[model samples]
Target chain A: AQSVTQPDIHITVSEGASLELRCNYSYGATPYLFWYVQSPGQGLQLLLKYFSGDTLVQGIKGFEAEFKRSQSSFNLRKPSVHWSDAAEYFCAVGGANAGGTSYGKLTFGQGTILTVHP
Target chain B: DTAVSQTPKYLVTQMGNDKSIKCEQNLGHDTMYWYKQDSKKFLKIMFSYNNKELIINETVPNRFSPKSPDKAHLNLHINSLELGDSAVYFCASSHPQVRGGYTFGSGTRLTVV
Candidate 1:
């Protein structure tokens, strides 16, 4: 079975400072990785996803994540933090063997709450 | 218009009561899913339906049942609700062809008293 681990439960960063959230997954084969963001009382919004190709994948809202296969990590990063960017973030992994028929059921990590301070 | 919508944004009921949460998607996607977000903010998939057919059913309690009337709608019904069942439930839809990420609803917060 696949699983995801997010090391940080909560993180605080000042505006304009760089931020990185760590995520690691345990899966057998090449996994489909995704990063999602959720505001308070709102559903999750996709930040980015990695199926294959480039190691560094850019996403919405000036966020990006790098897939490091050797380390089993897909950490989300931003060059500078904004107050509006503060939210709960989750990293997920899905099996590739699920194929088109299964539509890729995901195993999500315990979210990391980001707090951006002025 | 909302791409994905879940009715009763908040539901508060006594334990042992039964309740249902309805979800509908307007994106014309063939796949719909139900996810539970616990107090710790951990999201876990509960069930999935494709074209009104059950696809993935997680190891959730039997009290939690999902019914899909069609490809566009999936409803969750919980019986003998417990305090542990109190959490935010999310509905999502996706297009299988593009491998596009899911579009999620605002979520329904169910509180058991």
Candidate 2:
């Protein structure tokens, strides 16, 4: 079974400050990790995803995440946060089976609500 | 064009009534999924279909049925809607091993009165 845990339920960061959201996962095999943001009344938008290789991956909206295999974590980071970056963040894990029948059956963690302070 | 689109973005109905939510993906992905986001913001997969074939069905109650008519559409119908069923339902599609293939539709907020 695969699962994800986001330790921060709510995080408040001042605008222009750096931000990091912690995510930990448990999977027996090579895991596919992703970060998604959902604004108020909007659907989820993929921030970044880690399939394989390259511990550091860059995503849209100036967000990036580092995949640390030893730590079993893929934490999202932003050098400088913007006010519009406030949203619900979710850490998810999924995998592609060898047969390739299904994918994106993600196991998501409890979302973290990000609040940007002016 | 919206890659993944769900109908009736907002739905409110009385308990014991039945309703359906329709979903379609124009991205040409063969796999589609349904997920439920509870009030606490915990998301869980409900069902998944591949090319109109049922592939994954979680512990969802039998009252909540999923139907995939074709490769592009997956519909969810709830019989005797209950208060507990009031939550946001999301439809997503993705192709295995394809970068940037996964896409999610604007969720349908169902409020059971």
Candidate 3:
């Protein structure tokens, strides 16, 4: 079984300040990680995904995450956050063997809600 | 056009009244899925269909059923709606290889009153 844990339930950051959301996962096989953002009353939008590549992967809206194997972490980071960045962030992990089917399904963490202040 | 779309974005109905949520994906993906997000924001998979065939069925109750008419549409039908069934239902689609991850719909918020 695979699981993801996001320690922070709520995060507050001022505009123009750097932000980092921590995500940790436990998977027995090769893990495919993903970050998704959701606004209030809206659907989830993919921020980025890590399958197999450079540890640092860049995503839209000036977001990036690094996959740390030894630490079992894939933390999302941004140099500076904007006011519009206030949303709920979710971290998910799944083991996609050679077949690309999630061992069963993707496991998601308790989302972290971001509140960007002026 | 929305790649993945769901109908009845906001549905409010009395308890015990059955309802259905429709989902369609324009993307040429081979797989479609249904997920439920509880009030506390925990997401769990309910069902998954691949190539119009049911592939994954979680421990959901028999009252909750998913119907995939074709490869591009998967609809959720809930019978004897209970208060516990009130939540945001999301529809998603993806290719088998995890190419670009999955595409999600705008979600339908079901309120059982």
Give the Cα lDDT of each candidate.
Answer: 0.91, 0.91, 0.91
Per-residue lDDT for B24 in model 2? 97
B6-113 per-residue lDDT for model 1 (tens digits): 999999999999999999999999989999998888789999888898988999999999999999999999999999999999999887532467889999999999
Quality of model 1 by C-alpha lDDT: 0.91
Off by over 4 Å in 3: A98-104
Question: Model 1: per-residue lDDT, tens digit, A1-118?
Answer: 8999999999999999999999999987778889999998888999999988999999999999999999999999999999999999999887556443446578899999999999
| Pairs in clash, predicted candidate 3 | none
Please list the residue runs of candidate 1 whose C-alpha ends up more than 4 Å from where it truly belongs after superposition: A98-101
Q: What is the lDDT of candidate 3?
A: 0.91
CAPRI level of candidate 2: medium
**lDDT digits (tens) for residues A1-118 of candidate 2:** 8899999999999999999999999977788899999998988999999988898999999999999999999999999999999999999988866665345578899999999999
Q: How many clashes in each structure?
A: 0, 0, 0
Ten-residue segment with the worst summed lDDT in candidate 3 chain B?
B94-103
Single out the weakest 10-residue window by summed lDDT for candidate 2 chain A: A96-105
Mind giving the per-residue lDDT tens digits that candidate 2 earns over B1-113? 99999999999999999999999999999899999999998989999988898988999999999999998999999999999999999999988553454689999999999
Cα displacement (angstroms), candidate 1, residue A80, comes to 0.7
Q: Clashing pairs in model 1?
A: none
